[model samples]
Target: MICVGIDLAAEPAATAVARLDADGTTLRLRDLHLGADDDAIVAAAAGADGVGIDCAFGWPAAFVEFVSAHAAGRMPETAPTGKDGRRPLAYRRTDVEVQRRTGRWPLSVSTDRLGLTAMRCAVLLDRFARAGEHVDRAGSGRFVEVYPAASLRIWGLLEPRYKVDPDARAATLDRVLAAAAPIGTTASQRELMVRSADAFDALIAALATIAHRRGRTHPVPGHLGEIAAAEGWIALPDGGLAEVLRG
Candidate 1:
């Protein structure tokens, strides 16, 4: 099976894509690309069994509703009372759940700068829809939303300060590779991962996609199913990295 992972940025210059192929019980890094544009991402994902993207699929439903109401001059009579009351507008259900599980909040697509990147993701999703793929933000379909840091945390491979510290990032990569033994990577790929956090995240996104495909990640609770379908679910691994490699 082939799975593609994309670390999407607000623009093409910072985007990265990783293509992973699984054969029997072995996995290989078939291709890695930096500065990947939308067309390149689509090409990378073509014919793959699953495509995992490190970007929010959509904004919080309440946020969208609020924006629409404000645009139409029909704002709510009362403002949200406090942080707790405003959270539903700023953070999606999945984001809240991820924070509950990992004790760290993923970027708020509805309120953070990550929304810029999410706009790009929105276009990509539309492209997939145009190609006849049924997009399911809850991750019931081929294209699933992924959070690399959350996935790593759930799998016990996350390293503190890895995102901004080179040494920590390298250590995190080493731990991930060691945990998922029998996965093949060229020396240059390892070098790139150590040098580019985006590349490393793309690889992790692919692995998490593999876990999702194999039923190794937590499922959306039935109670939140409708909200998740609208807000997009983050696929958090429920097992160690080795379990993802098991055939």
Candidate 2:
């Protein structure tokens, strides 16, 4: 199986994509692209069994509803006045569940700068749909939302300051390599991961895609199914890297 991972940025210059080929036992890093544009990302994902994107697929459902109601000049009767009361508008159900399981909150796509990247993701999803690959934001189709940091935490490969510190990134890469013994990477590829946090995250996103494909990630709770489908769910790995790569 082939899995493609994208570390999407608000613009093409900072985006990164990684492709992995898994043969049921060993997985090889077939390609890695830095400074990827939308077309390049679409090409990288073409024909892949699963495409994992490290970006929110959609904003919080409540946020969307609120914005729509305000635009239509029909505001709700009650308004949330405080952060606590407005929490539902800022964070999705999946985001809340991820925090519950991992004790760390993923960025709020509804309120944070990450929303810009998610806008780009929205365009990409539309492009895929036009191309006949309709992606399910709830993660039932070829494309799925993935959080690299959350997956790293679940797999026990997370390193402190890895995103900003080179030494920490190198250490994190070493730990990931040790955990995923079946993963094959060239020396230059390893160096790329050490030098660029985006590249490192793209690789982890690919691994997380494998875990999702193999049913190793936590599923959306039955109660939150409708909300998750509308708000987009984050696929968090439930097992270690070794188990994820075993496929």
Candidate 3:
């Protein structure tokens, strides 16, 4: 399937892109700092089936918190998990306000293990495409997807000759694609066999952006779900990250 991963750029026009197939090996396309090139790239991957995004798609932290506190309706449709400290609800990783300051993130599997390698490949491809920023951009995005470069070893979307995360990323994103496929989207499966192509487009873009933020990038931390299981807010010391990626 033609799937894309997105690294949200705080604006639709500024987002990054990472296009790929369902298996996550074949790199259909990748880019960072898409800027004016966004439209063409989107058109190229138009038929992709799925997309993996590096940013929170539904409700940003502010809205999520408001809903949890009864200030608004739940946006994600799922509820926070882990009430007894054993099992925890895991949501997309993202930055947050902590102790009156901003820019705090819950501990998550490094990007390397959680599909950062593919992400960086997208970044490098971006440099090749537009040839501007040499480093990956690290703007506000989903907490689960973004991490320190040390956390992710890969630099761009071009498949290594190999990978470490294997099916974790493919399967996790499959959840998204399967959910969307039946609804009839702007993109479709059966045709290209690529799922979440647009979302992955942004993922590639975000990884490229992160590369720009860090001097170099690598792919590591292959077991992010496990890490989330261990460090999810429910397991944490307090009420902090409990919501995680859950609804």
List candidate 2 segments past 4 Å from native: none
Backbone clashes, each candidate: 0, 0, 79
Against the hidden reference, what TM-scores do the models get? 0.97, 0.97, 0.28
Model 2, 1-247: lDDT tens digits are 9999999999987899999998886889999878999999989998899999999988888898899999999997896669898998989999998999899888899888898899999999999999898779999999999999999898888999999998999999999988887688999998899999999999999989988998888898888888888889999998788876776
| Preferred candidate (TM-score higher): 1 or 3 | 1
In model 1, the runs with Cα more than 4 Å from the true position are none
Compose the digit string of candidate 1's lDDT tens values, residues 3-119.
999999999888999999988668999998799999999899889999999999989998999899989999888856689888888899888889999999888898789989999
The whole-model lDDT of each prediction reads 0.90, 0.90, 0.32
- 2 or 3: which has the higher TM-score? 2
Tell me the spans in candidate 3 whose CA falls farther than 4 Å from its real position. 21-33, 36-45, 58-247
Worst 10 residues of 3 by lDDT: 233-242
lDDT of 3 by residue, 128-216 (tens): 33644222122211122333121222211123211233344454334434332322323332222233333444543333332322222
Model 3, position 33, has a per-residue lDDT of: 32
Which is the better candidate, 1 or 3, if ranked by lDDT?
Answer: 1
